[model samples]
Target: MIRVTAALSRARAGLMLALQAGLAAGLAWFVAHDLFGRPMPFFAPIAAVIALGSSVGQRLRRTTELVIGVAAGIGLGDGIILLIGAGPVQIGVIVLLAVLLATAAGGGAALIVQSASSAVLVATLTSTTGQPWTRFLDAIVGGGIALVVMTVLLPLNPLTVVRRAADPALRAFTGGLHDAARGLADADAGEVRAAVERLRAAEGTFAAFSAAIDAARENVAFAPARWRARGALAQYVDGAAQLTYALRNVRVLLRRAETALNDREPIPGVLPVSVRHLGDAVELLRQEWDRGVEPLAARERALRAVAESGRAYREGVGYSGGVVVAQTRTAVADLLRATGVEYAEATRRVRQAIGWTARPHKARRRSGRPGSMPS
Candidate 1:
């Protein structure tokens, strides 16, 4: 069933790509005929293919850069053309000026390629005629056609991508957090490790979502609200990272508990509440991430629960049991406290950094040392 679903998804994606390609080709043809006053030769097809294959977001950015670069190149080229005279020397000066201008604009390899292509276009179409502006306008028209086609036909909307990606990523994060919390509660080392790994993978998915948003921003036709949502989603990624780290520490503590149990002694009364609170926190984070909104009271309640669990664990280990068990409990309690503190700080930092309202509660402050109960 899963394999069939996967196959269907791939097929749909392929269909979308085909549609986008066809749209780009049709638009490129129209623009070629309208601007050049005749059917375009091979270059129109080539340009359409390039535009279709290129990332819509990246192509838009490159177009803007190219426009700026071309304008600068023309200004310099014209100056050089005037200084030298209309001859082999003039053409040579134009090429030199194009390269220099492109380099100054921080055009790497792609810019160099664009510069060479633009230089050729100027030389063949507009050189010695004393009008670089006309050729510049032509390049803009070509680029504008490409941008418009991309925006209007089968658009690769970043909001849609981010929204689609956020659902699964949030599920993974929440599910992983739940699993880790259960593992911590039950003192199950393997489950905790697996959950943490899944959470780490979810972080990568969020990164991809962020990249997609960046691409979408370059499309002039895209909605401003979509851009704002993307920015909001980017802020949420930092929160997710902090949650992942806290969960990872919980896994480590679970491992320590496992080791102590194997030694025929385990920490007394340490697992249950810790896991429950952690799970609650994970769920809250997942909700916020998916919806791009958070309830401060709910988040604060979850944090308090986790902190309480850490406190309980610390209290349970205060007495010396067997040397091995006592030391193990102490270590686990320290880990839990550290993880809880880190999680709290991460949530607070995310709120402050993003200008979100801070929860109206007393700030949590951990004792300077590990053995003390978390406050």
Candidate 2:
């Protein structure tokens, strides 16, 4: 059932992209063939398709690269054919020159590949008598049409794209946090280990989130229709790095938890409860963000988690258990920061929750050792 749902979701996204690509290709062909009067303008549609790449974030860059690559390849091929004549040997030489030149120009993989492929096509397909810039102009028209199709005609909803990408990653992280909490409650090392593995496996989901943010930001920046989403996207941009930190901190918390269980450390009841509270906080934050509301409840939950972790520590814990408590406090701090709290304020809140109050004289002391200063 899950596989079927995933396939359907993928197909829907694919259909949308295909529609855009098809529209861009058709428009490019019409412009090149009718306006430019270039009979059989095959390169036009080809360039359009290449520019409208599958990766949402790369369309603009790919379009620019495609135009430049086409120009370079066509010019090099034409110049080489005029000197050496078109043949098997000429094709190889043209490809080599195109690849080398693109590489020297610090072009990406797409640019280099496009350059070589265009050179090969020009060398084998077109006559030397054709104008050198004819296909280059066709490439420009195709790429231009693709950009217009992507940014102006069929711009994706920035908020929708971001939500789709973020939900899966956030859900996976929340699930992992819950699993770790369960492991702590039950004193099951195996469960904690499994949760660790689950989080590690979610790297791809996090990568997708990053890419989605990039695409959404680009849409907000360029697509006038998507400009309204900029305010919503600001939360995502502000929280992205902090969210990553929070996930990492949770992973560390789980590992410490597993270690504490394996070593037969006495687990405090508040430990598992605190972790569960943090998981709840994360879910609440997501829900509130979707509803376009302040994450006040989520922040309160996270602060409570930190306070409970401190109480757990004050109740007396073994070395590994102490580390677990410490990690819980830090993780909640990261969550607080993810809610757009400034770093210093978040740190102060976490410290206050953890029952740490720095004395002014302690700050003046030159102490480099860990925990050397009074709090």
Candidate 3:
């Protein structure tokens, strides 16, 4: 059932992309063939499809690369074939030269691949290697049509894209925290190890969120209709790094928790409770983000987690347990920052909640980096 629902959602998203690609290809063919009267303008539709296939983000840059690569490869192949004549050796030399030149120009994967592919097509397919600027012009028309279709005609909703990408990441983060809590409460090292593995597997989800943010930014920038999403997107922009850090810190916390359980360290009940509270805060933050509301509840819950972690610390823990407390403090600060709090303010709030008030004569121990683990 879950797999079916996910498939349906993906199909819905892909439908828009398919429609955009079809419209761009058709328009490019019409412009290149009917208007420009170019004979058999197959390169036009091919360029359009290739540009769109690059990625959902960076449409303009990808289109530009596609057109330039096609033009350069075609020009190079034609000039070389005119000089050396078309044969296996000539085709190999032209493709090699095109690839080297594209690489030297610092072109991306699409540009480099398209350059070699275009050179091969020109060397093998064309009988007479005269000036083939018509193919280059066809490429330009195709790329321009792709840009228009992606940005102006069929831009995705920025908010929808962001939320859809964020859902899996946030769920994984929250679920990992809950699993860690359960492991700590049960004093089960194996369960906490399982949680660590789950968190590690979420790297792909994190990458997806990063890509979605870039795509959403592009949508809001080029599509005037998506301008209203700019305000909502600001939170995601601010929180992205902090959320990544929080996820990392929680993984570290769970690892230390597993160590503590394995070593028979004193695991306080409040420790697991605090972890559960952190998980609750994460879920609340996602809910608030989807509803476009202020995440006051999440902040409150994170602060409470900090207070509980402090209580657990004072309950007299062993070395690994103490490490867990320190990590919890750092994770709480990161969660606060993820809720749009400023750095200094979030640090101060976390310190206050964890009973770390400064004293004139007493020196406090410095906290280590958030996600670093002891060897």
- Highest TM-score model number: 3
**Of 1 and 3, the candidate ranking higher by lDDT:** 3
Q: Local distance difference test, per candidate? A: 0.50, 0.81, 0.82
Q: State in Å the error of residue 369, model 2.
A: 14
lDDT of 1 by residue, 1-375 (tens): 999999999877556556766776666566666756543333444345444555433546665555445444444554555565456666677777687767877876555555655555445454455343444444444455555556654566555555565556546655765675566556566776677577667777656545554565554235443444456555343443444344455445444544544444444453445445445555555555456564353355354444444444345442222222222233333323323334455444333422234433333224223322222
- In model 2, the Cα lDDT at residue 233 comes to 82
Which pairs of residues collide in model 2?
A: none
Residue lDDT tens for model 3, 1-375: 999999998899788778888998999999998998887888788777777766564445665787678767877877788788899999999999999999999998878888889888888887663344666677778878887777788777878878988889889988988998998899888988998999899878988888888878888899887888899998887787889998888888888889889999889899999999999999999998888888899999999987898787567677777777788888888888888998888878887787665632123523332222321
Question: Which has the better TM-score: candidate 2, or candidate 3?
Answer: 3
Worst 10 residues of 2 by lDDT: 366-375
**What TM-score, over all chains together, does every model reach?**
0.53, 0.86, 0.87
* Order of the predicted models by TM-score, top scorer first: 3, 2, 1
1-375 per-residue lDDT for model 2 (tens digits)? 999999999999777678888999999999999988998778888777877764465435655787678767876887889888999999999999999999999988888988898889888988887666777778778878888888889877778788888888888888888998998899999999999999998778888888888878787788998888899888887787788888888888888889989999888899998988998999888887787677899899999998887777557667777777767777887888889898888878877777676645456256333222322
Model 3: which ten-residue window has the lowest total lDDT? 366-375
Candidate 2 vs. true structure, TM-score: 0.86
Sort the predicted structures by lDDT, highest score first: 3, 2, 1
What is residue 85's positional error in candidate 3, in angstroms? 4.0
Clash number for each model? 0, 0, 0
RMSD of each: 9.3, 3.5, 3.6
